[model samples]
Target chain A: MAPTPLAVSIAATIASLVLLFGVLELVRRRRLREKYALLWILTAVVLLILSVWRGAVSGIATALGVSYGPTVLFAVGALFILVVLLHYSTVISALTDRTVVLAQKVASLEQRIDELERGQDSES
Target chain B: MAKRCLAIIPAFNEAGAVGDVIRAIQRERPDVDVAVIDDGSRDATAKVAREAGAIVLQLPFNLGIGGAVQTGYKYAWDNGYDIAIQVDADGQHPPSEMSKVIDPVASGEADMVIGTRFREEGGFKSSAVRRIGIAMFAWLVSTIIREKVTDTTSGFRAVNRKGIALFESDYPQDYPEVETQALAHKHGLRLMEVPVQMEERQAGESSIKLWGSFYYVVKVTLALVIGLFRKPIPLPEEGGH
Candidate 1:
């Protein structure tokens, strides 16, 4: 037997609520940065809205010429995951670049400090 | 005006060989100042290099070969060095051959001088697989830049003040040795290579292992091809600094 529309909606609603609470709890415990948490919160909110409105998912799927409504939920979930993954990768790339620059700066500063100390020793 | 030359050695976990490399440069080219960029090595690379009388720049974390070398270039540029020579800290590059590579840049005949081991006279030879990969890169680079590039993978190079200024701001951070030549060419820098003797690495395993060589070729080739379509990096405007 196929999963009933009511059961699907309830499952989506529960999943959305779990994600929203999980994200908020992570932010509250300082396990996640506010910037990153914001993205998850937005995702959870959108998923929550689609689950609670019940007809919104079917309406969007029908409008897009998709025959099945549940497929839309799966599609949106997959798209959301892809987007979040891309976002994290971009963030990682940026952090790597900054860390390199920081390392270079720290190294140069240490060298300068050493030179200054040597100069002082010689002068004394 | 006499040229102030700096030998920039980027070392990562090269504690076993870094000190000897620094001392060798001192012994061979006493006129040149030695600066070692310790690329966040967990080993004693910084201490050994400093004890050997070379100035050490201790990076807080590892930035691989490219970032480490770029850091050296930035140091050379900021410190007002007239010529910057790159020497591998693993002892593959002979310190005695530095003047040979540096002479072209010093005389203003070339903005960048690469020390090539692929020449008929150079005694050093890499594994057959590596040589093939190097040849392929050399061919690709030569075709695009319209200049014969013998050793695109050579890390031993000397760059004049102008070249230093260019690399200080923009340098590739991944597998940079081959791509940097193309970058130099794109920015209108004259490039030439001279025959230089090399020895087997004294210590520390090669960064690109046998298994990783395939990945290196693929990744670097893709980067070079992609770079061809990208707009050339603009030179810093004069009097902007």
Candidate 2:
């Protein structure tokens, strides 16, 4: 396996570190719920491990007959992105449906309250 | 006790047409209580419906046709309505023909009755393209539900308490008319079609434009097929949310 450039490896490791810390900061600040941050944290940790142990990717790439090591990383990275996006799609669908139900209930209750208030006013 | 009937008129920006639609229902069925679901219209839909002697449930914003209609169902379910008929606010569903749809449900003949424009002729038959689309959708929904549904996309429907409970708890969100029959059938609710004369919409355009017909087909097909796999929700508790 051709050795990855020292500068490139160092930059990747740093970028991965930044991502891990960034997600952690968001979690600490309560900006991201743990349920959602769990996937992000897992992603950052995997990215860091791959960047630091550069040989792991190139070694697998050579076995798979892939010409370049980074190409394999990008391919796997794209698949990871697709899976995350699909998860997001499901979350959004469920949330919107729940929102619709909530809106319906709230509207109904508000009308009921208005009628009750009008009844009280007329009774007095 | 007499069955409590509710005429649910779901309206968007059809202020010009909604008032007359309400009056027509009052004229045809004085015993049935009318409730108009005002789906966040920019005009005076809520005011017009209320002034026309109907209770108006005004949504805070537009919820599309499905959401609006489901809101009406929820209201029917919550208030212990024994029968609910969904008529469009645009006047396409003539309230004059109200009994043709309502009678089946009231008499315990069917859990739900869809008022079809395709049968018994003489009224708006829809455009050439819409007729083809209506046919295809009927085939798809009929095959899936194992029921012969002629006008699968007709929004004009009447539902008994059973059907109302089924939908208020679990209703399709988009292009709901086609999927609702399948949903009701799967839950063991009986569906029947009655021929009724419909009029050209009194105001505003249909939600589905001609250009979006292709997308409508694909989306509705997906919703119908995907729906069959979902587990049926437990029946809603009597007289509760």
Candidate 3:
């Protein structure tokens, strides 16, 4: 038997709410940066809206001539994940570059201090 | 006014050859201060360099050749050096040929000067495969920038204060020797190359292996292409004094 539209909507709404609350909890605990949590929250809210408004997905799917309504949800979800992953990768790459620069600065500063101390000792 | 020159030698696990390199440079140019960027070497590179009369900047971790060289540039810029030269610490670069690379920069004729091995008759010839790769890069860079470039991968280079300011802040992190030429040209800095003698490494292996060479070619080529489209980095005000 095909699952009723109401049941499908309830399940999706619950899942999206769980994701939204989980992201908030993580942000509050300082485990996830608020900047990144905002993106997760946006994704969850969009998913929640789509699940509540059953006709919205079907309407877009129909407008796009997609036969399956659920397929539209899955496709959009996959795209969001890809975008989030790419964003994180770029952020990580920038952080890695900055870390290398910081390490170099620290090393040079330490060497300078050593030279200064040595000069002082020799002079005394 | 005479420019204060600093020679920066970036070394990694090169204890055996770095000391000799430092000593040779001091002998060749007594007036020029020498500093060795010891890139997290487990060996006695720092001790050897210091004993040989080089101020050593020992990085806490290995940041590769580019990071190491940038540290030298930063030191030069911060300490009010008028000229900065990069010489590898593996003994491949001949300190006796330092004048050949430094003269153009010191004279204000060029902002940056590179020491080329191919145009010269006396330098140690590279392997055939490496030579081919170098030739290809030379051709590509010259064609793209419309400037004749004979040796794009030479690490021996001298830069004036303006060049120092540019490189100190925005040097490429890996395989920078070639791509930096494009970068220099992009920033409207004058570039020149002089023939200089080079030698085979006296001790220790090259950082790049045979397999690594292939990757190096691809990575540098891509970097050069992307670099063409990048917004030109603005020169620092007052050339970082």
> Candidate 1 falls in which docking quality class?
incorrect
Candidate 3 DockQ vs. native: 0.04
Q: Please, what are the lDDT tens digits per residue for candidate 3 over residues B139-201?
A: 988987788999998999999998999998788776888889988988888999898899998
Winner by TM-score = 2
lDDT of 2 by residue, B72-140 (tens): 999999899999999998989888888999999999999999999878867775678888988998998
All candidates: DockQ:
0.06, 0.05, 0.04
Report how far residue B118 has shifted in candidate 3, in Å. Answer: 0.7
Tens-digit lDDT string for candidate 2 (A17-43): 898878766644446544465566667
Q: How far is candidate 3 from the true structure (C-alpha RMSD, Å)?
A: 10.5
TM-score of chain A of 3: 0.90
TM-score of every candidate relative to the true structure: 0.70, 0.71, 0.69
Q: What is the C-alpha lDDT profile of model 1 across B1-241, one tens digit per residue?
A: 8899999999999999999888989999899999999998999999999999998988877888888998998888878899999999999998989999999999999999999997856478678988888899999999889999999988999999888888887777768898899888888899998988889888988778888776677667755765675566566543432
DockQ of 2: 0.05
Isolated chain A: TM-score per model? 0.87, 0.89, 0.90
DockQ preference between candidates 1 and 3, better one: 1
Q: Provide all candidates' interface root-mean-square deviations.
A: 15.7, 14.4, 14.8
In model 1 chain B, the worst 10-residue window by lDDT is B232-241
Candidates ranked, most accurate by TM-score first: 2, 1, 3
